[model samples]
Target: MSTTSPRRLHLNVNILHSGFVPSAWRLAHADPRAFVDVAHYVRVAQIAEAAKFDAVFLADNASIADQIDFRPITALEPTVLLASIAAATSHIGVIGTASTSYNEPYNIARRFATLDHVSGGRAGWNVVTTADLGSARNFGRDAVPVHAERYACADEFTSVVKALWNSWEDDAFVGDKTAGRFIDTSKVHPIEHRGEWFSVAGALNLPRSPQGHPVLIQAGGSADGRDLAARHAEAVFSASQSFDESASYARDLKSRAAAYGRGPNAIRVLPGLTTIIGATEADALRRRDELIDLIPWSYSLTRLAGTLGVPADTLKLDERLPDNLPLPGGGNGNHTFFHATLAQARTHGYTARQLIRALAGGGGHRVIVGTPEQIADDIEHWFNGGAADGFNLMPDALPDGLQDFVDGVVPILRRRGLFRSDYDGSTLREHFGLQRPVNPHARMETPVVAA
Candidate 1:
């Protein structure tokens, strides 16, 4: 194995239904029942773990989100599902999405802390300010909060959550059976947070997690989104359709983080990548075409319309896109994808139909259809060419696709000295080469008392 100084590639499987393909469930051998089956999810998580993947991510929504009637919805709540996944797997990191817009800081803190403890520090939370207006009605509001307001609330929300995580110092818990003392009461304090959006009493009910706090992750590529990520996120999940866009995004994110008094390397900017792998290039292309064919043209057109803020009826399959469409009114929605799609369309002079085909499977995320070697080449090129630090892998199909990666691409990466063959540590922090967070009270240093 070749030893490298910059370290190996980090791969995380984004478990979105069967995979990144919109019609993944429609595949002949695909299990329709797997959508709700805990065992099916566990099986996929195991596959990812066997590949020594850094994490298994689950994107979530607050309420009945999107076209739930037609699409396969996110059925299980993320935390609960991650907990089940934690029980089934030992080492793979469990990352779950939670919306800052709908959840309170205290609840989020407790849920993630509990996950970390259960997973032995293999936990991460993908912090998001939810976008859909449907979620608002469920939360007793008629409309979703404006973009800036949601992020403003998120900033304070995350701060309070971190404070709560630090409520009990690392050494606070002592299982002293003889003295009948369970925990050091002096070491625990309430956060007493009173912010514009939320107020919460301090002191998380759970003890400090194995990693102190589960890794904080953020997604969304708007200006406010980037700002929030710079201040608090350890990882930022992004979507870009091309190397040029991904590289630009990486440069901007790192620079923004540096300006925030954090090291540029503090955050890992991983763009989502969906792969359609096959033994040969032609085979992969055929597989990709099959999935694309299954997508309803009407469904695809409607989605593109919503994302581009253009009327669906106005766009023609072969007609070139019009210049300068209006942006989403609330400054939200998938802005990253919006910009990326526009850039792609303008760069290639693609007709509306071509744009739909390109983005049909994975939205604006990069989609690759090739042999394992070809896929590896693309990943290496992106890593070395400044497009990304790592990649969020969304396979075209689950179980089988992941297996192909573990069995095929992983060995190629290992041979090229681009990935680790064996795990180096237990915690996600160790896996990511990040330092363990020091306890807040440790820096304060009260004198230790012996009981």
Candidate 2:
């Protein structure tokens, strides 16, 4: 909402294995084995860096959440892969998803802090709470935590990690050989925190990270999720099927952030966007149809049913979705994708088959099919309309699909002066036009000798 400076759009690519389309791995040029290939992710990151993208994001899963028999899964661990990516690319920031529901705060704090150090401050942590049954079973739990319980823990978990990050003041490390002092002990403070979900006595193991705290990102659409994002997230990955929905979400989130004593611009709302590009509208339509057609009707129907929390048997390809669908897992499963997918179906009154095609054989996120000019125009309209700060792009396919976007749409955005053409700073914070947080502990304890 601040008008002192020209608004700049931010972009991050969700390196979703082969692509957003489920059948993208079937593409002739795509490597079917790319899901676990480190080189593949590195290649995508390098291309994004070339396009001057703000970051390349990776979504994580503790267990194989997808139907891996028919498709590739998110196989590699995020932070480790991101470290490899950071080694391969210089400018593009690396953001990785880690679930707060399962992880202890200290380890996450240490892991990302190390990434920021090695990447020269180009790291972000996307905090998510695991919601699926497989992940729960893998973690030795019989059932997924209730929606409120998971978010409550996540809120506390994030706060504890932040406190640990702030435990050491910026000037805590001092290598004064003459003074025989390797550290300014007084500058390091312990956060003696005891809370319902976590307890830690601490100063972090490492010095303050390059960006103070690596950029905090969150993704969720439920009320608890929104409150968590408003309370702690620096940026959010969102799912809304339409521009008006995205605008409404943005306003609500910013309002919540304001209520928490944060500035309206404190949190960036980035909706999930899937693009299927071609030389023209007809060409793009052909490609979308081709990809969707590759997917078996069974797979799309099953996926849709899962998101809607309905039995796959209940879905008929030619029939419209059943009315009065309940929230997945008794209101505890993923709310973002569920709502987004349902909104798309209801808004268009699409049958199961139509819904599947609209979503490109997968579930959730908005899909755009067209030429570079059209994609650029849509992105412009959303950004200029305050519908989104930008998008977390999931192209129809990877490396190749991203190449199309960078080579095509990026130039148009650059021409309009809506996005950056080159890296202006080494840190992710600088890339996003965000400021490094001042350590509250440092500020509070700075002695004021009477002037």
Candidate 3:
């Protein structure tokens, strides 16, 4: 779309506990403790790295957002867990989520900068604003911050983090024995930032990270979210359900980025895709049915109700969704997921039961059940048709589902020249074809003249 060839496809695996499905833990091969075990995550990372995938992503929540009795929750602290993952895998990127709603800018800046150095530049931060009241309670608040206020805080929070990242020049470090110097004091400056949400007056203790600031990623789909991504995000992980929907979203997002003086190529829009692969289309469908059948109707209905912001009893399993359902929490509660769910139900006129099956694996991402060729075709269609740059793949089950994709689907994609056969670069930025950002302060000074 930005005069760049749209031939290469970038992919990342979203390591969702056992897998994306609620019943994934029930699978014969699934380790019930995979959610908490470091070995489980490291194994998944190794698989993705072996496949030459761009990255392996870890999504986080400050509070339990799902019914944990039935499914394993995201239990580990992401940055800490990803540090172990970084050590286990050498090429794949390690990206983890952290919320701006509850963290101070300085702490987040230092944490991610440390991750970048630890991972040899194969680190990324998924910026999110915690939206659930459960998380608010954990932070000693009675209610979640209003949507606008949260975004405002996030806007300022990200700005301060960037400023802190830029506080030290690239060559600020100088370890010289003869000169007896460790750092060039003149090359580092305190940020001295003051904003609505936070105020700080100091440079970061850490030097510039390997990838400048570790690729900034955002996942909100509201207008405010789009604006934030337009202004700051290098890549967006979106929840889009259809080709038309994703294409439109991509167009609108790029336009907004252009309005902010960023190039169309500057922001990559990768929609979420959940794949249930098998030897044939029918086998794939059977696998989908097996997973859906394992989930209790009560759990499914309750999950759907939560997304729709309605009581569980209000929904009838056999009936279509209520006409003109109101936006969840008056458009404040999980807006992206809410809209995506509604679109899927309304577009297909799916009954409640059908809708649950459709979303059983991915929440609201596009779900495809097919053989390797069919799955490859779906990915190619989206990539070439401008619906997505690539995808953040959520396999229906962990290691096994991912293995099926890598052994079956990935080879087809590679044979078609749509994906890489091997890693060409070591850093995540290089994997995504993005430039390592230059420090803004480095270009501001002119050489002093000796008269």
Leading candidate by lDDT: 2
RMSD in order of candidates: 3.1, 1.8, 2.3
Worst 10 residues of 3 by lDDT: 1-10
lDDT, ranked from best to worst:
2, 3, 1
In model 2, which runs have C-alpha deviations exceeding 4 angstroms? 1-3, 444-451
Could you say which candidate leads in TM-score? 2
Query: Per-residue lDDT for 323 in model 2?
Result: 92
Put down candidate 3 lDDT per residue, 1-451, tens digits, no spaces.
Answer: 4896445899999999999988999988788999999999899889989999999999999899999878789989999999999998888999999999989999999999999999999999899998888999999999989898889899899999999999999999999999999999988989999778788996999899988889999999999999999999999999998999999999999999999998878988899999999898999999999998888898889889998899999999999999878878777789899899999999999999999988874467778889999999999999989999889999999989999999999999988889998878899998898988888889566879999
Candidate 1 least-lDDT 10 residues: 62-71
In order of appearance, the predictions have TM-scores of 0.95, 0.97, 0.97
lDDT of 3 at 3: 91
Encode model 2's per-residue lDDT on 1-451: one tens digit a residue.
7668678899999999999999999988889999999999999999999888999999998998888889999999999999999999888899999998778899999999999999989999999999999999998999999999999999999999999888889988999999899988788888899999888998888999988989999999999999999999999999999999999999999999999999988998899999999999999999999999889888888899899989999999999999999899889899999999999999999999999999998779999999999999999999999999989999999988899999999999999999987888988998888879989876565778998
Candidate 1: tens digits of C-alpha lDDT, residues 313-420: 977878988877766654566577788778778888889888877765446777788899999999999988889878999888877778888888989988988888
lDDT (0-100) at residue 230 of candidate 1? Answer: 90
Colliding pairs, model 3: none
